[model samples]
Target: MQFFKQIKSILAVSLVLLFMAAPAIAGQPKYVFYFIGDGLGAAQRQFSEFFLQDQLKNPNSQLVMDTFEVAGINTTYCADTLITDSAAAATALASGVKTNKGVIGKDVNGNNVKTLVEEARDHGMKTGLITTTRLTHATPAAFASHNISRNNENEIADDFLNSGVDFFAGGGIRHFIPASMKIENADALGKTIKSKRKDEKDLVKGFEGKGYSTFIGMKGAKAFKSTDFSKQDKVFAAFTYTHMPYEVERMNQYKNVPSIADMTRAGIDVLAQGDKGFFLMIEGGRIDHAAHANDPSGVIWDTIAFDDAIKTAYEFFQNHKDQTLIVVVGDHETGGMGLGMDSMGYKLNMAALNDVHVSVEDTLNDGAGQYKGDKAAYLSYLSKNFGLSNLSDAEAASLNKAMVSADAGETLGYYKLNPAALTAAHILSTRANINWTTTIHTATMIPMSATGAYAGRFGGYKDNTQIAKAMAQTLGFTL
Candidate 1:
């Protein structure tokens, strides 16, 4: 008996020593928050911070991402090009693989690549996707579906039915219902629902049949409270017929539309019900759209909204510090945004955007609707919406040219945006000392900031794929 007891004691001590010397398996993250700010480059992020501190004069205000413990930069080139589109960049971020532009959750050869969220679901972790763009848009689609082309949004919406995602909230209602189906209050709410799908399949009913707590439009979303989310396991909330309204537009008029932060909070509440863990991806996708339009103030507003979602995650991290990880990065930079124009010398006056009430998209696309070649009316419209009252001779001349072009239904620049709106946005940007190298994406490296559970691994320079590797490793898996 004494000999047996001695052997047992030796084995116990050896096990304790072995665990002490070995890396911690228990430290693996159970909850992960991945925030991708589409088109958020270094300059864009810095301008946002500067706007809050200097322009808004809220010196105490700080971006929640800035409070992260680890900061890093990552190269964003795709397999075929140095400058990547959102589809390819998102594939790399989601699956740690280089893919051609327009590919989602696939490799260069069109092979389906498993993504972090998919892996999380396979491991019995609940998963969610939230975005300001369509739910089937490139960034969100990469994590939940595989496709050869990002343009096949209807097919992507079909994938959502099989994605096994516990929660999803955003736009893309047009991809769900058939065109023959008409929404009751769509006209009153400014919502359209002509399905983009080739078939007459009703995806909203599919979700309902699958036991998802599905809701449509801002009105349905508003009916739920914080406590309501915790009671449901699977949820699908579509807030708009297309992409969600820009943050500026949403705050000004679309008060019913849920912000990115609202979606994040609801996702956390719902996903936390799973016994194992959860993976949630929140994207401020409108930042890219606003940037594509070269709308500086619009970009800042959406970026701030993105940070607000990050703040929501940070609050969750505070409670689950040991088992949670929050990572914020941009898939790619759009607009080639730069602070301080040559005319401004060393001064940058971002506050010029302060008086602006609505986004360029809202001003030109929704508010203005159509132009009638009335230059005075156009000027009045600009003054009413964008607060451009005292136009210099040069500014007036530029506006006059753009106004005529708009009246002729001409689109300006490579992106083919409305001539008048683009002109006004550009002029306002100049006054704010912001400049753009391109209206589209750039090869600029983006920043990554993280806090909690293996965040230190993200501190050094990395390729975009390596970001996926780090997150996968944190979750005790290989990418």
Candidate 2:
């Protein structure tokens, strides 16, 4: 009886151990959503949070990404330079390999590196790519195509057509159409269309032939809304000719174009139809564009749009908690953006953002041109749009000088901040305490946050390549 009792005790211990190890033995996540906020660093996110708090009049408001359980800092250096471009940074995040600047999915010696999206597709998972920039742009292209040069977007478009990715939504339909094709109709925004392709292939038609449900503009996207996604195995949507318009600009001007959240939801709906689950990459690409242009308003609104998309993914993760993994990160820091300026002495007035009615791009294109060489017109424009009042004599002179210089075709080299744009930037910065060090990418560590299955693996400081490695491990992909 004593021996039998001892045997029972041993059996109970064995059962407990097995039960404890069950999670480790279980398969990895079936769904993965990877979001890349291009040029979004810690400073950018903090600024956006502050802007949101002030804009919404809620001090307790937080970004969707800030609510994630696992958070870490990621170093964003390419093999060639400390400061990385979208191409090299994205390739590192996609392929778990370091490549030089301007290269995509290949090493310095030009060896091909398989991306996580390809791995997911190889493992029978559906794949999707959504971006506010062109689908063939560096970030999205790195995930789905390989090219020695990021500029080879024409070839990249062809690669995307053959990539087996289940869904795509963004801009750059020009790359799909042959240069020989005459485009008579305007795009969704009433902009004249022209093909950027060099070959004779109508890739859009080819995509249709391959069973992809293609949508060109706002009209097509609206039509797509009524489609039964369960019957549509593949879907592709493009809203603009090049990159999608900035969120602030889009809100104020192009109401017809789909939002980042809209594309994300559509991609999720289509990709979720697969039984084997899916890998979807959503890029807030224009944040980088705005930062490069040193447009604070544009950057802030686009980041908010990106947060909305994150909320959409978070909502989906709520239901498929056990089967999903969502990771949000940035490729690199752009514009060296900061919340406080020297003039403000650490007092950041985020409320000033609320006074601005339009973007710097809009101010340059629409307002500045109308007020060329006219100081009163420029000052009045500033007062109406950016809430600037009582401009000093020096400030007025500077504005007139800038307008005159811009009118005369004077250019600011490298950083590309023309005199007129610089004046607008200065006003916004002085009002909001926002500061920018440079109009280019910086060698800064970006924030990375994750939740759901295997999220704990991503916590703590990591290299950009490590992110790709961790996701590949979570997906059981041998990168």
Candidate 3:
């Protein structure tokens, strides 16, 4: 009897010890915020930080991402190449598997791989996707769609509607509307028109049929802000027919469009109501677009906009510190961006970027053609928008040449910059001490940061696939 009592006592002490050690094990997070900055890398992040310091005149100013407790360097190579496009990089980050270029949520052999978002749905957790790009764009599409080709956006849109995500906000409504249903917008002064879908399926109506609260365009999104998100089981908000306007252009031209931060907040508000927790992915997609154009001003503003979304997610983390996990990462780097040039040596005047008022895209579309025949008007516009002053004789000659070439109906490659816009960008970049090696994607390692519950899982050097795996593990799912 004494021996049996001793055995029971040992068992009781062991149980007590186990209970005491329980707090050391990290519990599964109730909420996860995955922030993907497409085409953002170390240089891009540093450039944004420098810009903020220069703009705010606060050397101590820091981005919200800088506050994360754990940091990692992520290798962004896809299965097929050292350099990865948004589709393949997003696939690796979402599905814990490397995929070929232009693929979405599939391996090299064309096998469908379930994404972290899908895992969340299977676990009964609410899922949300928010992006500055279209909802069917590469980064967000990888989370919800399984397609052999990323270019099949119409099919991707169909996948998104049936993916069971609770909230989605972005652009690309054209994929949902049939071409026959497209109409000229009188409100846009006939300058803008609706996109036509080939399949003629009304996806907005389809979403409504499935009990989703749908919001389209600026007006619809504004109306959504006034609705009770808690009462809505699912919500979809798309602000543009394609990708949202670049941040610089949006601020100057499209005031009605919602910011990425705004969309993220709305996503959290709606998804947080789920009983089984939630997973949300917010993408600052225009950073990639601007980088692809090799436009420093556009890239800086978009990075700041992305940082604003990070701040929003951080605020939510402050309240649910123990139950939330927030991770910020970039799919890949574009534009081989660097801060210093041979002419500038080591000195960088980031404040010179403030002179840029519009994106290269905006300059090409709006200003270049308007000034094609008028030299004086063109120079004055450059002075006002690009802050170029006291142009040398050679510079003036080059500008005139560009304008003359543009007037002669010269066209460059699809990805090449407009001659007039390129001149302006070169002047601004020279002043800002920013240089770009290529306009295409680079085989660079991107930075990742994490905070809140189980953030340590993301620390150290990791492959992009490991990010998805860590997220899965944190959510108690097997990748």
Misplaced by over 4 Å in model 2 are: 1-25, 182-185, 225-230, 362-381, 386-390, 413-415
Using Cα atoms with residue i matched to residue i, what is each candidate's TM-score against the true structure? 0.93, 0.91, 0.91
Top lDDT model: 1
Give the per-residue lDDT digits (tens) of candidate 3, residues 214-234. 887756756765777777789
lDDT of 2 by residue, 195-240 (tens): 8987888889989999999998657756765667667789888766
Q: For residues 1-479, could you state the per-residue lDDT of candidate 1 as single tens digits?
A: 99999999999999999997654466788899999999999988988888878755787777889888899999999999999999999999999999999999999988999999998888789999999999999999999999999999988999999999999999888888875876655621376556677788999999999999877875565764334788887999886778888988888877777889988999999999888889999999999988888888899889999999999899999999999999999999999998887988998886688887777775674455334577788788778778678999999999889888887878877778888888888899999988988889999999999999988987779999999988888786656
Give the candidate number with the greatest TM-score: 1
Please give the RMSD of candidate 1 to the true structure: 3.4
**Model 1 stretches with alpha carbons more than 4 Å out:** 1-24, 184-189, 225-227, 365-370
* Local distance difference test, candidate 2: 0.85
Candidate 2 is scored at a TM of 0.91
Worst 10 residues of 3 by lDDT: 184-193
Q: List the residue pairs that clash in candidate 3.
A: 178-197, 179-196, 179-197
State the RMSD for candidate 3.
4.1
Q: Where's the lowest-lDDT run of ten residues in candidate 2?
A: 362-371
Tell me the lDDT of model 2 at 278: 94
